[model samples]
Target: MADVSANPRADREENPLERQRELMELLSQETRHSIVQALLGHPKLLASSAELNHFVPSKSKKTVEEQLEVLVDAGIFALYEYPPNEDRRGLPWKFYGLTEYGADVLGDFNYLEGVPMARAVHRKTRKPEQIERHEAAPRPPLPESVRATFRLDEETD
Candidate 1:
């Protein structure tokens, strides 16, 4: 295996923003980003999918699972398999935490400010369709009664 400490020539050639964008694309959803942020806050700590569900209450199990797979594939998270003796009769429960690269990217954001990892990630992962959906489908206008109830122009005399 090649020395892991040294950056590959290819990686060196890529611009920093591009790399951050790739990382962000891997962590696109709110749930996935929350998971990574939580792990960054607590390094090397393993969190089960159930635990993750608790952390991101809005996301469904299937959604979280998909995000976790993406993170694992992107090398942002390390998945650990539980020993057979620990739990039997079901699929092995996997715990995930941030990898060294994940940590570095997060750390560089908090400490260095040398690169905008979060923005880059958002830019890379955000799709034009997604933007259009959000923009085109504005929320329904508030009920007239509800709107009248909180009129900013009317002042208590």
Candidate 2:
């Protein structure tokens, strides 16, 4: 019989760039990146569609669903049903968490294995005082004419 156990590191040592490229492609999209980050931070926390929707509020439901599908297809997440409970229809809601492969990828220490730019820069630069002061010093609201042109529900089909 052929050897069933092979050292995984052999492949990475053989083609590190290719593996890095694959990882980067998987996390290229902002929504996809956010989903991965969320799962990474809370591995055991099952995130539902609604929870994901709230986590990435700027994205539409359709977009969030698409991201979840992509992650599942990439083998980064697994889907499972929530247990039946009161005040709920118990309809199967997709929950996502990192797979073994995902954990391995995340654990990889190579800098090339992730987005080229670090997300920490944005967080470090945005001080709470800046946000609070900006919030308190809000400028005039949008003009009525511009407000009339804006429709929150308007979306491209």
Candidate 3:
């Protein structure tokens, strides 16, 4: 569980950056990360627990349910109950979707698109030095014909 400050004034003062950091921490958990990615990727499409099981097949249902509750409590996920018109059973199964705030939060992190500078780190593989070297290297000159087509040759003249 994340630590909550008892002092309201103190909490207010510290919340701006801390809020984003807290969200990042929540997303850093692999299961939670996967859940968020799946939800965001699909937008408003509601996903049932059974459908979501595909994302974290290795985890027990209890664990996944608990995590879903955590996300719901955090306001990152919206839970939907089926309409009462249908003759459903006593216990209503819920479907999950990203809340508006959830979509904004995930968008802020560029979670759907690949991370800009972090793409080099794949599957826990870190090659910071290589990434730095790649960035520092200059691009090769464009072919003259291609450049001429774009009127770059006139710019030089």
Single out the weakest 10-residue window by summed lDDT for candidate 2: 138-147
Tell me the tens digit of each residue's lDDT in model 1 across 1-157.
Answer: 1122333224645586777676556555677777665433221244556555555567888888888877766655657555542454333245665555544555555522422353354335433443323222212222233223223125231
TM-score list, all predictions? 0.53, 0.53, 0.56
* Candidate 1 local distance difference test against the native: 0.49
Candidate 1's TM-score? 0.53
Candidate 3 has what TM-score? 0.56
Model 3 Cα displacement at 128 (Å)? Answer: 41
Each model's lDDT comes to 0.49, 0.49, 0.52
The true-versus-predicted C-alpha distance at residue 60 of model 3, in Å, is: 1.3
In terms of lDDT, model 2 sits at: 0.49
Error of 3 at 150 (Å): 35
Q: Which residue pairs clash in candidate 2?
A: none
lDDT (10s digit) by residue, model 2, range 35-127: 765443321334555555655667898998899888766655556443342234433234554444544555564422332233342223333
Error of 2 at 25 (Å): 2.0
